[model samples]
Target: MTVKPDWLRVKAPQLERIGNVKEILRDLALNTVCEEASCPNIGECFNAGTATFLIMGPACTRACPYCDIDFEKKPKPLDPTEPTRLAEAVHRLNLNHVVITSVNRDDLLDGGASQFMACIDAVNSVSPNTTIEVLIPDLCGNWNALELILQAAPEVLNHNTETVPRLYRRVRPQGNYDRTLELLQRTRQLSPSTYTKSGIMVGLGETDAEIRQVMQDLRTVDCDILTIGQYLQPSQKHLQVNEFVNPEQFADWKAFGEEIGFLQVVSSPLTRSSYHAETSQGINETLSTLKS
Candidate 1:
């Protein structure tokens, strides 16, 4: 196992703002991926009044080796009132941007796409100015379900590719590399106005060449924003850390991504999918001004 590096270490979450956000979440009974997956930047994100809400789950239907979320063959029914509570939390936080994600709900007929639409609508009703980003699962290759979610019109639709294709069977046994790419492609075709984003985690025994090739694959489908981060082992039962990618290598990947035409690239040992999500909107404004 590679020794945990100093660069990866993070400061403890400070209170006041973070405490207030937690209080609102607790009162509404909502979940965020920051707490559920043990994200390294939870402190920074929460203290800044931002969070990636995880709707429809703390449990998952698929058990990927690298993921920390628990799996249940038959998860309980989706809550009818959860969407309003989530929207209320977004309003209370007064965020300009928000991320909403979920577990792989394969047990559901539409892979929980209905809930995504409902959540998007709820957030819009309460906080219309708050841009929404959904870091979604592959929806088990349900294109119609993907279409359903697109109809609600989020500002950014993100679905993480997670790892290189060769590692799929081991790293993400239930996930499909081609299917994931297809989902992104379909998203672009369905809603060109909605910026399509995808992310991948490195340090899973994937070669640098493989990572670059995956970035190219995403570009072929016109994926806009890219994120590359080191994958930390979640527990003894989860996949062991193959390597701790150095910060310099992450910088190289970032440069390469920019060169290949991604609007923004967030690459670092501590980067996660939702890390600095609000920055993308600012980037869009800058690019729009430049174009004009």
Candidate 2:
């Protein structure tokens, strides 16, 4: 394992605020991707009074070697009360924006799409002013299931294209690169008003050219938002980091993404799918203003 660089070091967040957020999650019996996936920005985001709620599980159906979320061939049944509890957390946290993501539940026919919808509706019911973002799975290419998620109409729909095509089989064996692009394309076609977002993790032995090509491919599907971040190895069992991407490279990717017409490009060593996600609504306002 390679030593993490100084740039990758995260500053500790205010413990009081983080504890408050955790208390709410625990009290409500909810899960957050931040803790389940071992996200580095947990403290920062938590201290800022935000969390990316993990809905269906902390246990995933797929055991992707690169991810930290636990895998269970037969995970527990979906808790019908989860949506209501998650909505209560959003209301208590008084969040201006909320991101809801779920583990891959291939055991279910709908791929947990209905759960995503129920969560969306629940949040809207209690916190109508809050903007909703759902970072979803490809649903094993179930277009009809994807349609169910779209019907709920989240303000932003994100699906991470976790790695380059060349590394897909090794990094995301259950996932298809083309399917990711198709999902984004379908999102644009199905709900033109909603923003389509995707993310990529660097330091996975992918070439600079490969990263740029992924960005270009996302643009081809009219993905509106892009996030590029460094991939940190979760455990010794997981895939080791290939390299530490420098800040300058992240800046270059941001510039290239902007040049390719992405409405927003968040690239940094610490950038995650929902890192500072609330800011995205401003882009919608900006685009609307320009159109007006």
Q: TM-score of every model?
A: 0.95, 0.96
Tens-digit lDDT string for candidate 2 (1-292): 7889999999989999999999999999999999999999999999999999998898899989989999954688989999999999999999878999999999999999999999999998998878888999999999999999999878889999999999999999999999999999999999998899999999999999999999999999999999999999999999999999999999999999999999889999999999999764447564334323
Q: Candidate 1: where are CA atoms >4 Å away?
A: 72-74, 280-292
Worst 10 residues of 2 by lDDT: 283-292
Q: In each prediction, how many residue pairs overlap at the backbone (N, C-alpha, C within less than 3 A)?
A: 0, 0
lDDT of 1 by residue, 1-292 (tens): 5679998999887978788889989999998999988888889999988899998889998888888877854577999898899999999888778899998888899999999999999998998877788988999889999999999988789999999999999999998999999999999999998888898998889999999999999999999988889999988888999898999999999999999999888899988998988764436564333223
TM-score of decoy 2: 0.96
Worst 10 residues of 1 by lDDT: 282-291
| lDDT per model vs. reference | 0.88, 0.93
lDDT of 2 at 240: 93
